[model samples]
Target: MNLSEQHRDRTDIPNADWESHMRRLRPILDLLKEKDRTLGEWYLKGETAQEALQHRAYDGKAPAKTAIEALSKEYGRKNKDDPKTVGIWNGIRSDQIGASLSLEIDGGEIFPKSLEISLNEKNERRGSRLGDYRSVAEVLSEVVRTYDSFYVTYGPFFYYTNKVFDDRPGVSWMLYLPHVLTSSEVPEARALIPVTRDGKQQGTIIVSVTDEVFDVNNRTHVKAANDIEIRLADQDLLPRYIDL
Candidate 1:
């Protein structure tokens, strides 16, 4: 039987559009599965399916807020007298900062060791001056170099799952890190650019390190270092495999 006829006679099926939907959804699902595989190895390190989902949800929201807060404090004016500062602060307070980031790896195991930053929010300007480093001493040094006028911090690391469903839409997830750090010893730095997947730029993940946490709608408190999981977002970006 042809595709439409086969689906039509399958009374057990839940919907009439089942076959058509599956045809379109199959590729997306396969892509999601591949993403999950790559991200799972990097971040989950053998967590259960449910555990992975929980981790991604938490990671996505927390770091976005922390990044927003860190940026606000740095650019916002301290005195009540500066109208520009006050205006900027008020604008930020009223806006919502969304999260959209991922990582790009060269092979299956190696992290690219570079990041790219994309700012889509209004009145939001990201700088490299915050205390952002792998160590505390480096953060302190950046502070001295900037003459105590500037600072930088690292945002949270995000993680996600790599599972895909055959009949369901392809699913991807993300988690944001818990702590924020500033650049005290070294100067602010830029993230490395990512290449396109399948001749498209949508799948590339961008990342950067910063020095401080600015103010946002929600404030993020730091969690222990061991508690953070480092992973990138997982989503559908390629075609699926099907047995005819």
Candidate 2:
């Protein structure tokens, strides 16, 4: 299987100050930059970096830093006429890398706050060596370490394999939870990988099915993932399975 192809890795953290969210974006932006330097430039819907260049947000050539600083100011502003409309909705992407980072900065929603980083199949095949559970788990662990993310899911895009959650892990290759849980909390077939940050065990990463990189086409792998999902639900570990 092409382990990294069509991968979607999402992470969720509780809502916090806007500054905290900007701080969280730094490392993630850095990670994307490692994939494609030009992807560091941030932009809003219906706007382009070249078009935004003349705007005050550019503030020099450092796209990532300046754009986030500009977004912070934007987040703090309010519209007297429509207070609900006063929010930030922006993202960073690169056509060259075929990867993008999308953020949900609105706080009025019922869902846990989250962000998603997606890599198209072509880019994944060329740039990523995520052929096993350990490699993909490490990538997810990086986000957890940077954001202290309480929840994360990494797997191929649902459309790529015609897989859906359906009250199970179905398409997800791995799930990360900040709270510690024993192996007894998961299915016998699953692997509970411990994620450490700053020398402390920050959370547990539940690998779906097997150590082999998850293949959505593999019925065994999909069922193994679903099995772990059911077990986690039984232990009340998955309060909101689909956060992003």
In terms of lDDT, the best-performing candidate is: 2
Tell me, by TM-score, which candidate is best. 2
Residue-wise C-alpha lDDT for candidate 2, range 56-135, written one tens digit per residue: 32223333454545554554465312111112222334343444455554444444445576655433323343445666
| Alpha-carbon lDDT, every model | 0.22, 0.53
Relative to the true structure, candidate 2 has a C-alpha RMSD (angstroms) of: 6.7
Q: Cα lDDT of model 1 overall? A: 0.22
lDDT of 1 by residue, 180-220 (tens): 22222111212222222245422211122223322222122
Cα displacement (angstroms), candidate 2, residue 120, comes to: 0.6
Q: By TM-score, how accurate is candidate 2?
A: 0.63
Q: Please, what is the TM-score per model?
A: 0.17, 0.63
